[model samples]
Target chain A: MHELSVAQGIVSAALSHIKGTGKVREVHVAIGELTLINAEQLAFAFEIASHGTPLEGAILETRVIEARLRCIRCGREGKSFTCEECGSAMEVLAGEELLLEKLKLVEGDGDAQGI
Target chain B: MHKVSEIEVQEDLLAANRELAQQNRKLLDESGVTAIEVSGAIGSGKTTLIELAAKELKDYRIAAIAGDVVASLDAGRFEKLGIPTVPLNTGKECHLDAHLVSHAIEKLPLNKLDIIFIENVGNLICPADFELGAHARVVVVSVTEGDDTIAKHPAVFRKAQLAVINKVDIASYVNANPGRMEEDARKINPFLEVIQVSAKTGHNLQRWFNFIVKAVEDRKQHGI
Candidate 1:
């Protein structure tokens, strides 16, 4: 799936942020519902892409955010695709995000036990 | 003792691709090549539309990059038309990213080309997520695919600058309503320019050609 590319992107971003720091322990990413990325597939892809890199054995955590749409006709905001009051088309206001939110790094001793 | 620290970093997942896309945009602009990304489902007549456009826009030098999962069948068609064609086998990739396109540009005779059309892998969902630094994005939907195809794939339509409803000649036989397809596309993207054409019978193909010529002219004038 395209999640492989997405996972590679996440690994790249995380590695860039944690450059010169200690080994990465966990990576937290936020994907919007509109992106249509499967969380399980992303984790698998991340594991594969991170192999032999500093991110090896790092835990991948994903958080899916709900889509938000704004009604064009009624000026109402909600998660639904259509306006509940006016029954008109709604514009997507959010939920297209695919961001590397945060990273957990272990400093000092590089003990791989209980990772 | 090992200490775990949480660092808050908000970075886009597609940042790397987007950065390369910017570079591509600059390259296309500097080379004065009007690039357009054409995306659609399999057998939706994407190659046919490009073929027709190449014939109609004979005054301009045209080159095309065809992307497919396995075969370069579409690229062969372009070669037959005498247009310089580059076929990219994406292997496991669903769509062609900017990185691949950047490499494709290096192989082409950019100095002689006026326009470069990128026919994305036959799919709607994945191609919409990628930006290949094209001046415009066109999505083709044929009548044989059903009128609801536009409504079914809103994400692609939303990003596309133009929507081509092809195969109007077979609309009656296939029971596909072209009007509904245009209306659905408008619902998704109100500003999206739409045209109905039949690449087979050359019906309304002139309009499509005119659109391309105008886009190229506008890009040249605005330097976009």
Candidate 2:
């Protein structure tokens, strides 16, 4: 599934950001509602994707953001494109995103000292 | 003692694919090609729609990108119709990504094409998440697929601007309710244009043809 690919993506991202910092403790990710990614499934996918790598046993922390829509006519914010007041078409402003927010790392045998 | 530090990454996980999709759009725009991504369930008649378009539309030089998990059967069908087509095999992947499409586009005679119909591998879920950089996105669902299909697979339906309900001529035989299906789709996507047609019988297929024609015209006039 695509989740496996996405999971590997985050691991790579975390490692890149954590260069000489430490071994990864947790991978924090923020997903939008429109992406349709199931966090549980992604976590399961991360388990397999991170296997035997430096990120093994690293935590997968995902936060799903709700989609925000605005009416094209009245500029009303709502859940979908259809406006409740004037019944006009809505445009999505946010909530269809896949972002790797940050990586929580524990000190490793690197030059970086604990904060 | 364990020392922890939260390193800010702020990387867009889908940026790589999105970048490729943008590149594809740029290529299409430069080549003056309008692409329409046709996605649906396996038996939803996507290949048939392209074949019909190839037969009916006389004004444009059309090409196709047939995406299948394994064989080139759909591409072969398009080739038989004298449609310049590239067969894209995704192997283990469920849907066609922008990278594959970009390569497929390079393999075609872009200068000879007015439009390209990219027939995505038949599956609703994966394609919804990946942007293939087409000018328009349409999801084909049939009455035989059940009226509840729109409600069940709202993700793909939501992503599409058009919803086509195919095989309406046999609606009665299959106990299918096209009306309910349309309503279901409209409920999920208020702006989705729903068209009911039987590709086999050529019933109201002119509307689908017109949709493609209008898309190509709009792209040409407005410039994608």
Candidate 3:
């Protein structure tokens, strides 16, 4: 349930990135497999936080990546789904990421604000 | 009229929490309080161990921060012991992060405390992922929880500096093999300090108490 804290981070990051912009259209996030963040909950939290801010009505899109593990014993780089070589427990090298990947800010008038 | 534009961005979502945790860690270091965090499943007697410590360290100015989902009852229990206890209700959250701990610390008279104990929510899985600025992380397990807890939650057990096997008095009635539990924990964490105690009856509680006192004293001596 650290998702609320995680969501607050997302909102802060998005607001910082979109400062000076007119409004925010959407927020893009990248979630890794091992982060334990629930996307739906995060989205809901974002919605609640974005209210009355420049980010109101913004959509939250999350891109989830599978966890990757590196085998220390065999020097094998593979997916953690299962270790093909050595069969030893795999050490996670990446994909535990909880990142605010992209932000889409809206500015300018409708006629000139071609996306 | 609405306009749409895209901005490429890359940021870390946990940056804020991590920063707060770092700040709390610094505060803990500066205040000279050796912060110890304990995590375990429900009914593992985490609070009982802390209560035992509080009783033995009556001369020291001690404080505790307890994290629970639905209750301030645990903190109330600690308050009755005459220790300053801060309750962090995580709502639906499963664990307390550095931010909550730091806030709770601010509410306590941190400068006067010799040691602070943080009892993480009753969980073995989620608490391992977050660091709450503790000098030591102790993982408690009762015999009834199962002998294989160490093996089942290797992540938690591996990260723990000390693994406590509580309720040793009931080990026989529950058919729990304490030796096997210790061995399995050792296999996961060879450097772990294993202490067996029955907090219900004060069985070997002195060992646990002495461990905390020594660890706190050593931290002060080593300037950690």
User: What lDDT would each prediction earn against the true structure?
Assistant: 0.88, 0.87, 0.81
Fnat (0 to 1) per candidate: 0.64, 0.70, 0.61
Clashing pairs in 1: none
CA-based DockQ, model 2: 0.54
Count clashing residue pairs per candidate. Answer: 0, 1, 0
Return the top candidate by TM-score.
2
Can you write out model 1's per-residue Cα lDDT over A4-75, one digit (the tens) per residue? 878888877787788556888889998888775889999999999999889999999989878998989888
What TM-scores result for chain A when each predicted structure is judged separately against the true chain A? Answer: 0.90, 0.86, 0.82
Error of 3 at B44 (Å): 1.5
Tell me the docking grade of candidate 3: acceptable
For model 1, the superposed segments whose C-alpha errors exceed 4 Å read A19-23, A65-93, A107-115
Q: Candidate 3 lDDT, tens digit per residue, B2-39?
A: 55667778776555566777788788878888888989
lDDT of candidate 1 over B111-178, digit per residue (tens): 89999999999998888777889899999999999889999988888788899999999999999999
**Residue A91 of model 3, lDDT score:** 67
DockQ of every candidate: 0.51, 0.54, 0.39
For candidate 3, please provide the TM-score of chain A on its own: 0.82
- Across residues A5-110, which tens digit of lDDT does each residue of candidate 3 receive? 6776788787877756466777999998766678999899888878877777778999887878776678788874234776554567766678788887667652
